[model samples]
Target: MSGHLLMGALLTGILAGYGIAIPVGAVGAYLVGLAARERFAVAASAAFGVAVVDGAYALLAVLGGAGLAEPLRPIAVPLGYLSAGALVLLAGLTLLRAVRRYRGPLTVSASSPVRAFLGLLALTAINPATLVYFLALILGRGAEGGGALFVLGALLASASWQLLLVCGGGLLGRALTGARGRLVIAIVSAVLMLVLAVAALTGGSPVG
Candidate 1:
């Protein structure tokens, strides 16, 4: 029975992680595009930023369950709006910077990888979707009774998927080295971010 329970928790955690990470939303797009510009080291940091938050949320869900969700419910709408606005602003800034870089003698400065990680971390943290998803999983997936092993399983799965995304983004960067390719990707990602922002505000399902 103990072994069976462990296997059940493991499978549940894997499902929960994939459920949250599989969606390619504005955040995902920005991650890939940013990596396409900044390369693997920075992108890996950013990916960890996202993964950490997801793990934290999973842990919270397991510990607090619906009790946690209830308190956050009241603020969900306002937080959603705030997150949406932030995403829109980020999109605009990315587009503006891309255009400026393209128009002039552009020098790409090496950004601090720590900053990239923290920036993505904050961005992902603000998205209420993470909490919501974890809450649903905990409530519906029999996670409330599971122990630390369950949370560990969820964290490992989420981190693995996020790292895979980083790898894909790195490959994309290697393949698209030209300025034109970068600019095009930047613009496209910006547009996607805008759409995601609008969706976030309107109570649509989360992509990141």
Candidate 2:
């Protein structure tokens, strides 16, 4: 039973992590575009930042379960809306920056990898809905005895998927060498972010 429980928890965590990461939203889009524009190392750092937030949330879910979620439930909706507004602002800025880059020669000051890491981390961590999502998954899974392993599994799964995204972004960057291609990518990503933001404001789950 112990072995079975461990395996069960691990599988569940993997599913949960993948479920959360698979959706390409504002953050994911920005990540790809940023990777396309920046170095592989920077993109990788940002990818890990995204993964770290997922891992932290997974651990929190395992530890807190419904006990913690109860208090957060009341404010989740408002927080979601607020987060949506923030996303819109972020998207607009990203688009504007992209336009500037397109019009001018793409010149970027060398930035610390830590900036990417921390920026993505803060963006991902602010969503209250993510916590609720993880809470629901953890409660449903009932991995009481294997919480640590469950968290570990979720972290690994999230990390793997996020890294895959970084790789894809790098490849896309390489393929889209022209300024026009980069501009198109920027516009698409910004539009996606705007749509997701609107969805969040209307009580939609903003996971994607």
Candidate whose lDDT is highest: 2
Once superposed on the true structure, which residue ranges of model 1 sit more than 4 Å away at CA?
A: 104-108, 143-145
**Worst-scoring 10-residue span by lDDT in model 1:** 141-150
Instruction: Write down the RMSD of all candidates, one decimal each.
Output: 1.9, 1.9
TM-score between candidate 1 and the true structure? 0.91
Kindly list the per-residue Cα lDDT of model 1 for residues 1-37, writing each as its tens digit: 4788878887787788778887888778988888777
RMSD of 2: 1.9
Worst 10 residues of 2 by lDDT: 104-113
* lDDT (10s digit) by residue, model 2, range 62-122: 8888898888978887778777877888788778878888899878635468988997887
Q: 139, model 1: CA deviation in Å?
A: 1.9
- Give the Cα lDDT of each candidate: 0.80, 0.81
Instruction: Tell me the lDDT of candidate 2.
Output: 0.81
Stretches off by above 4 angstroms in model 2 are 109-111
Which pairs of residues collide in candidate 2? none
